[model samples]
Target: MKKLLLSLVLLISFLGNSQILDPVKWKTKVVQKSDTEFELVMDATIDDEWHMYSQFTPDGGALPSVFEYKNTKGNYTLVGKTKESPYKKVFNDIFEVDEYYFAKTAQFKQVIKVTNPKLKEVKVYVEYQACKEQCIQQDKTFTFKLPEIKATEKGEEVIKEEPKEEIVPTEIASNDIDSTSIKTEKVTETKATTETNKTEVSNEPVEEEKKGLWSIFVLAFLGGFAALLTPCVFPMIPMTVSFFTKQSKTKAIGIRNAIIYGFSIIVIYLLLGILVSLIFGADALNALSTNVWFNIIFFVLLIVFAASFLGAFEIMLPNKWANKVDSQADRGGLLGIFFMALALAIVSFSCTGPIVGTLLVQAAAGGSQIGPIVGMFGFSLAIALPFALFAAFPGWMNSLPKSGGWLNTVKVSLGFLELALAFKFLSNADLVLQAHWLEREVFLAIWIVIFGAWAVYLFGKITLPHDSPLSHISVGRLFLALLVSIFTVYLIPGLWGAPLKLISGFPPPMTYSESPNGVGYKNQGIVGATATLPEHAHFSEHGIVAFHDYDKGLAYAKEVGKPVLLDFTGYACVNCRKMEQNVWSKPEILPLLKDEFVLISLYVDAKEELPKEEQYVSPETGKEIVTVGNKWSDFQITRYKNNAQPYYIILDDNGKDLTEQVGYTPDVEEYQAWLDKGLKAFKK
Candidate 1:
């Protein structure tokens, strides 16, 4: 099952490698004014569907065109700032900013006066980002030479330089630079790097994001089906269908009304998703996954929901709201059918509300703004289908099992699962804060109790609220008891430091444990010979020694004559943990991770505070950087342009990339091939 999910993740990543978009073409013309003066003219012709932002575009998300003239102070003097053609001002919905951009054609001019007599050429580069359905970063380099001035015996006579033009093959930017500005003075020169060789829209990240939404949809759909079997909804299916059949003039009208009712139910849930998206917004969604406070709140919220599900007390909407919606259902028309759907939602809040709330939280944590909407659509569809189908074919109504003790049994079982899931959020917070409150063994112990007790309950050993008195376990109940027992047994070894691949993403990582090795034994993955530990290093699970500090890891790799494998991971990153448990622990890959590379695991979400002297303000975002995680996160965005976790990069002795960096690779063969490629490059 773990392998299957990883394969799904990889498949989505490959599909996400969409064609790269290059919507703007750049051409540079150097107009020679005299021996010392030149006007660098740059023209951009944009594609019909796309637009390029000007340098003055405000900070939001869009990239603006920027020009950098290298080594300028002693060599040349700027006559004025770079001038750009008038552009269109438009509002961008996604970033919510007033973007200044140009369509069709645009021109920019920079006038420079040469000061150095011996200087022959000056290099200039311009990088501009253009967007249509998606955005792409592109850049081009140009050089201007000093015009000739020949001296006669008595006086100086000038033979002027001719105007020269340089066309496209302009390099594009892969890394991020906050805001837009034309530099008169040189800051730091970066390597001209491209993210991919593909010359179309490289929106593979977008598709990978969709993969997460797809998973949420599937989970939510399953949740909806579970909601249908609960006490609040299952009986309503029969009674609601019966009302439609008896009240309508004909069977056709009855079926139509029922369909409308289901659609209205769908709309109601969709609106709830929309409301969630609006409240959180896109930027906040990114932080929801790893934020300590949010995780703690979610932990508390799920605990309350679990307690409600366990028959301690009921969770319900206000009685007045349901009463009002129920009254509207009696109006007898399309409006009445819609109100009937609204009433169902209000009435079934106790059972379905927790499930809906959980789904939304999970979806929002995916960092995709549209995730909740997609999840709610799937959830509502699963619920809505039954009402419409049953009304259309009234004869099928006899097939459903009679609502009884089994419904409450389902609810109680969910309560147990919820109790276990609640700890996962707490664990997320613990991992991020590195609080050491919930380590590996303690987490497994909690699950052991939760699942073990649930198994006992299934076998008729205990009773809870709404449970009918039982003499013996039913066949189905007995089967579920056996499965839960097997799973509970499976968790026992986890206390002694098992990977627990089956529940990889739920628990704390193997690194955050009472013992990095097993409970009493050291891992055998290390020390074919005795290996001395490096500074800032610790033994992770599988006895693979790793460094938490980047400089230490890289320095150790240099001393050991090995390549550096930079793992930009996160403590609360679900997929990051999944890769560690399932992919990194594999027999074929474990040796490579252990032996070939000096592994540096930089936790981007680590919440440890940096020292006061080390802390400084970021020039780009102007935010005060106070923590180690925030510093590394900035390093990643500034150096790589990508910001997703479980990001991997292989480097030689120096810090340059050996190959293109990759995000969240799960396939063993594919990942091994990438490792091999890096090894081969390092050898060269």
Candidate 2:
């Protein structure tokens, strides 16, 4: 029986690991405008089971369907950008089920406008990731040329179309362009030329990009390990092992039971994964990340969790209800063991609930179909393992520390972390509302108070319902508490004037603050208690200020005759914080930001929305625009077709693209290279 069970488990594991992406056939085409301009289109014949994301998804969700046009001379304008065919599919949520999809044979097209008509041929490069039951992605490029238009007569003038003609470029027919003008047009006299240069495109079938499956596996493993430390699972290690050891009456039998416990954990976690994948689907993960309502929901949930951690309340399953389930674990079979595990899980809800909630939230927010499953599995494995290991080497259990005051200390530390994390969500809302002045100093002020109170409590200056008095202070504990208290005091200087650079990115942008000194602050850290705007603000309370929105930023730059600097940033991103401290603080970078370019720091993680009258819901994703940050974040994702934060896009007046670099590049030289690239792109 044992051998049979082991073989079955092994087979299931093999099947899970063997999952792969389905085959997809792809094709490309070029619609030329003249010798210098053209539109490039890529089409994918997705298998019946698979579908790709559309261009306008909710920010923070899936990667926006992107078109990377390479080998062009002047510039590749996406001609109002790429659009996917529409479709409909069913969605099953915990509360309700709905259906959604874009059309079949999704066509992604981009129009590339060029300068220096002498420059020949352009290569359109495209990269995308598609997933079904399993996920596989590919990076492919399409290269084509603008076929030169043959002139019917010499020295004819070309007339530019109405500005409105460029809007919705895809809907415009090829015949709409002046066929008579192409023949007579001369290069120098060309006011604006529209040439429909259609190049026959062969659809190339391609495979998905092969990811380092091992890396994903390892990350999943670490996630499981972290889950075990949560209050819910840790206590079970000893109890489960003891139960098996007592029943087995032999070391070998005990070891086998422990192994079964671990296997049970894996099975439970995998089942949860299957359910999530089935319900959310792979593509919807993207929407969850950027959807304003979803963000709001996440914020509320985290607040509840944080409050519970802080001893404001305890969240748990009903006692009579949980006890009924626990009663079933003593039947003495495989089912009984499973029930036993469930009982253990239910009992530890108070301690483990917050951690599990946090992990699950993070995993879901990642927008990977497999994320929740992998995350749960990691958590369960951590919770499951000590039982088996202790059974195998029972003597090792003696070395473990007893649960006492230290356990309460651990809980308090975690509470601190939870309270700290809650501010980030709040900050997200604050930034979107244009509630500036909540800079890093404000964040520090609150933290110092929280920690100071905590230190006092540890020293028996205060006590909570769950805490005990310290009879005698250990030297080590005294030293640690003293150090923390001193650190708390250290933050006070920041209230008046201090460069708290260590956590610059964690707060709102520095421009929001009214710090007496001229030293600029990143829009991070502290938030003001009362809602108010700067006296010179041009924005309505909800609308973006002058030089805040993209169009406005470009206009301001044009008015000032300064080059435009577009900052794609987020409220929750940790790397952005590091960049502000390490690079932005560098004397060289600081001066450049203050004087060289017109800075437009767009916050991609802001959660406040416009009033109901002004708020717009996205037709593509069925999510509302609730906050100021949400508007800009959505604009960046849907318009620019990029989601990664800490992205920098440089543009000129008339909304011309200059340079765009995403994510953090640590090397100073690499950053400098981007700086130079943007300066040159603007010049062009």
Candidate 3:
């Protein structure tokens, strides 16, 4: 009775697991479109709450749905690229990409021309993933027979159709499937490759670039709010509104003119954005963010802006241009109001210049053509709000605080922020050059000093060139000083190798630090114990003791009698850094990675030239593998059929998979379990 009860429990558990594994039913149909052409329709009837990804997923994103036609002979020719039904596009925080997925039902169609009409059937396979709480990859194949047509006595073809085959849903355990069998060769050539032959498909998800425009606009709006608090622009606000209110024929007229003036400000800034887009072109401007010299120049520019903000000097346009615009402003008309707004823009150049330059730089770096226009629209909206509001309610002017030493304080504080931001651009330049000058500790040290000086300035111990006499510090000033002091203190621990999660992206990364362990000497330092590793072993600046060469890592793993943990990562991969900081930082995962597995991280973006003897043409991509990155990129695409970053694969010394691969999973406990499973498999 006990044995029978245990058997029943085991059966129930296996059945439950199988139901969770499979969540979608797939069906295929051949729709007759023309005499020679036919549409191969692949439909997925997904289970409740489960979703499938689209085929047009971008690079550095989730795995896209792929179809492989096992075309051995030239019987049928592909018409064009496959088309998918409309899917919802959402920003996935885990993957950090705008991914497209479909729920309920999805239909993908591929048009193909039947060159050999006598051909009876063709075989095609598909690989896709479905997700709900967790994602599960699926591979399935189908064979479709050609429809038979008979000639009639009336000279019309009589078509005879066979009953469609019913598809039954099947659940397969993820670990039970072989990885090699699932990987398929990507189809390239099609008959409808020309522009005229392209099919009109409207159901595709919206482009990911368009989604980021809203974020850029929000950032620009916040920047405008910051600029409004500056000395040069803040005082001008009430003064400009007052001029319009007093000079207008009536209250309504005054409000109307003020709104027009606000709109003029928006138009002027937007034109500047358009001019920048025209000059640099969107692509080149975006490329500037990663360019070494451009980043260096931007770093210097920000420092100069910071100096000007600190009251060292002023940045202004020619006096003649301001005078001419001011003259035009004196005319009593709508045109005069525009000139008046333009005059204010020129007059406030000393303060607004740095803010505008920063906004434009960020927008340009975003790599979208409309980014600058959208950003400037948001910025101008924030700046224009107060002018229209004050003119509409003239009595509100009495509540406005009188600008004095407080304005100078604001300017000086901004100077410190600009100085801190300059270091980020400098760090970017250093990272691209692979120069270790501005490492984690050094970057934190600089920020600490800058903020510390800011705190002193707030407390009236230090002053800039344009400061008024400080008889005593106000309560607000004292509070600000205390906050700054605390922030400065907080940064000090970061120099000793704290994660400093708040400012994670600002620094050059902890891995690039001079000392990976901490500021002072440590027992298990990344560099100190490197001599223990075998010859030809390369260590990252973080001192993980890895090998850049694949063969060397596998050989070492075999020597150590351990499995290989292949980490496919990149230098510029943001999510890779995040995983290292958040997930890999866990005590359980860190030791397993450092001690047990042979860690082999292949950088898919490495630019180092390969040896002449090693360089060759990639059979898969048909591109020359001239660099280290190219070789590994081809290897990943050909072997595993994946090219995404932060990809982890646990393999035995013989290069067979010990466990299924995963990408950018942040759940530490789950990842630890995965590692344990791999280790267990290796032991077996």
Report the C-alpha lDDT of model 2 over 377-473, residue by residue, as the tens digit.
7667766777668866777878876655655555665676666656655554454444553444566667778778767865667755566567876
lDDT of 1 by residue, 1-684 (tens): 965765565456534432233566655545555656766666667789677877755433355678999778798888867866555545443233335667777777787887887666667767666655334444555565444433322212122334233222343222221211122221112111111211122332334445567889999999999888888888899888888889878888878887898899999999999999999986566557567898899889889888988899889999999999999999989999999999999999999988898889888866667889999999999999999999887889889888888898888888898889889889878866778989888999999999999999999888998789887777988999999999999999988877777777677656677875578655353553235667678776466788888888888888888998888876534456567767888989889888898888887656699999999976644445678987876676567754556678889867778866767677778888778878988889
**Best by the lDDT measure:** 1
* lDDT, each prediction: 0.73, 0.54, 0.72
* Model 3 worst lDDT window (10 residues): 175-184
Per residue, candidate 3 scores C-alpha lDDT tens digits across 521-634 of 344544456457677776543456678888999999999899998987775455676677687767788778878888888887676999999999877656567889878867
Candidates' TM-scores? Answer: 0.57, 0.49, 0.63
Q: Output the TM-score of candidate 1.
A: 0.57
Which parts of model 3 have CA positions greater than 4 angstroms off? 1-212, 516-684
Better structure of 1 and 2 per lDDT: 1
Q: How many residue-pair clashes does candidate 3 contain?
A: 0
Question: Alpha-carbon error at 301 in model 2, in Å?
Answer: 2.0
